[model samples]
Structures are given as C-alpha cells and as structure tokens.
Target: MATAWFPLWLTLKVALLATLGSGVVGILLALLIARSRLWLRDGLDGVIMLPMVLPPTVLGYYLIVVVGRNGMLGRWLYERFGVSLIFTWQGAVLAASIVSLPLIYKAARAAFEEVDPSLENAARLLGSGEAAVFLRVTLPLALRGIGAGLMLSFARAMGEFGATLMIAGNLPGRTQTLSIAIYDAVQAGDDHRAGLLSLLMSAVCITLLFLSGRLLRARHRA
Candidate 1:
C-alpha cells in the first residue's frame, strides 16, 4: 500500500541528506582535530565522539534543550528568522546527523591522521597553499577511510529512531521515517507491516555496511 510505503521513502530521503550534512561537518572537524597541536585536541575529540556512547534519548534531550522554542539558539532563530526545527523533517535530519556523526568523525580523523605529513610538507615546499595541499595531497590519500566512514554513517542515519522521534513527531506522510514507522506499526499491533518495514530497513542498512567493510578492507590492502 502507498500509505505503508511512505516511511521507507521518507527515511531514505532523510538518511541521504543527513549523511551529506554529517559527512561534511565530520570531515571538517576531523581535519581541524587531526592538524591541531593544542593540548585540548584530545578533549575536543572526546566531545565529538560523545554521541557514539550516549543514549539516543539523552541526545534527543540535549537537542531539545538547545533547539526548543524557548532555548537560546531556538529562540534567537525564531525571533530573527522565524525558523523552527521541532516536529519537522529538517528536525529529523538534525537528529540523524548528530546521532550518526561519530561514525564519520572517527573514521575521518583516523584517515587524516594516517596521511603522510611529509607529503603535505612537500606540497607546501612546492608553493601549494594549505587548501591546495589538502585537496591535492591529503584528501586523496584519506578518501578511502573517509568513504568507509561516510557509508557507515549513512547506515546509522537510516536507523536513527529515538532522537528523531523526539524532535520530529511521527506524522504519517510527513515525518514518519522507517524506524519510527516500525515502532508505530508494532505499537498498533500491525505485525505484518512491522515485519515488512523491518526487513526493508535491514536490507538497506546491511548493504551500506557491506560496502563500508569492503571500502575499509580495500584501504588496508592498498
């Protein structure tokens, strides 16, 4: 039924956008962290990695505190721009991005760290600017690990439920993503729908993870 299939499509859309948002942010953060020599680098890395260990509900609570209508950032946005994230698809993307960030962050950081510093130095010696060196030398070398991380992050985003539920209420045809849809189906005693949705999501996530593993193994081989 079209009604039953909405969640799967919505989830794929959200997960793809979330992966893009998180991938760019994660790579930027990883570059910053990997290149920094400050003593606070490790502490910053720990902070970025927090979502990996924190409960999804806890992450949802933090997001609400920061993005709720009355919260500082949320209030400012509402007042200045009339923007609101709560109970919207964009909110779901934000939740997924936060929940999935750690996967890409860890992978990107490790990739950046593993890149040869001497290669970057040589680029600099050849009159390449910092940005040029990153694009021409650092990024190419780190692409494999970053790619693996991005695929993993995509899978994680596709499965994000708790945080997304809290921020973006399950509105059929609006924000009821695949994971939330499964929960809704189970709660409504629709075992058939629930099972079908579960299988679909599982298949998609498994494909993503398989590709990620292959990328990682290829990286190791290379």
Candidate 2:
C-alpha cells in the first residue's frame, strides 16, 4: 500500500542524496590527499577510513555525541538557526554519508593515484592549468573507478540501519529508511512486511553492486 511504499521512496531519496554529497566530497579529498606531500596524509586517511572498519553502533554513538542537543556543533546550530538534525531525515542522510564515505574515498584515491603523472605534466606544460588537466585528463581516466565508488557508496547508504536508527529514529514516513523499516516491521511482528522489505533491499543492493562491477571491469579494459 501507500504506507508500505513510503519507506522505499524515502530510502531512495536519502541514498541518492547521500551518495551524491559524499561522492563530491570524497573525490575532492582524494585529489587533495593524492597530490599532497604532508606528513599528516596517513593520519587523515586513517580517520576517514575508520568508519568502514568500526562497528556501526560505535559510529552511531560518536554521531550522537557530536550532533546531539547538548553537543558542541549541534548546540550551536540549534541556538543560532533552530536547525536540528537529530531524529530528522537530514540526520539519516548524514549518518548514511558518514558510514559510506570510506568506500568512495578509497576508490577515488586509488583511481587518482593511478593516473599517469606524465600526462598531467604534459597538459600543464601545454598551457593547461592544474584544474584543466585534472578535469580533462585525470578525471576522464578515473571516471569509471569513481562511478564504481559512487555505486558502492549508494549501496552502503541504502543499507544503513544502526547508525541511521540511532540518529534518525524509526519514525515512519519521516526518517524511517528501508533498512530501519525492515527492523521496525520485524519488531512489530509484521513478518510479511519485513520479508518484503528485505527482498527489496537485496534486489537493490545486488543491482548496484552489479553495476559497480561492470564499471570496474570497464576501467580495467580501458
């Protein structure tokens, strides 16, 4: 029914936005780190990649501490603009983005690292600025890899549950994503709904992964 479909649409919305936001940020970070000679690069990479290996509950706890009502940034935003992310759909998006960021960052970093420095240097010597070389040569070569990362991040965002539930709660039609909806349905003894949502989640994840694999293979070929 319409009620059942709400979670599906909401999940898609959150995943799409999270993937897009993270993709841009991740690629930029990757580029910066790739070109940098700073000693802190490794430390920065470790921090960004931590969420991938860390427990979801642990990440959720950190999110709460950082963005909760009494938390520093959270309190400032609330006092200044009355904007609260806790228990909101925006919070869900933030949770998803944080958890999936590592996948995009790693993949994009590898792609950027693989680009031939000679090519970029040639472009630079030919009157092309750094930005032009990156956009025209480096990005084109790395596009397939970045596409794969985007899909992987999208899948992770769509499947986000624990962190999302902790920050966004399981409010139907508001912050309840597909993964949270499945959990809520099961807890409420709605086995049919839970099963349906599970199948849908599996199908979507499979599709995204399949596309990601295709992109990776294409990158290898090119």
lDDT of 2 by residue, 58-78 (tens): 898899998889889899989
Q: For every candidate structure, what is the RMSD over all alpha carbons to the true structure, in angstroms?
A: 2.2, 1.9
> Model 2's lDDT to the true fold?
0.90
Q: Encode model 1's per-residue lDDT on 42-111: one tens digit a residue.
A: 8998999999999999999989999999989989988999999999999999999998999999999999
Quality of model 1 by C-alpha lDDT: 0.91
Off by over 4 Å in 1: 210-222
Collision pairs in model 1: none
Model 2: pairs clashing at backbone N, Cα or C within 3 Å: none
Q: Of the candidates shown, which would achieve the greatest TM-score relative to the real structure? A: 2
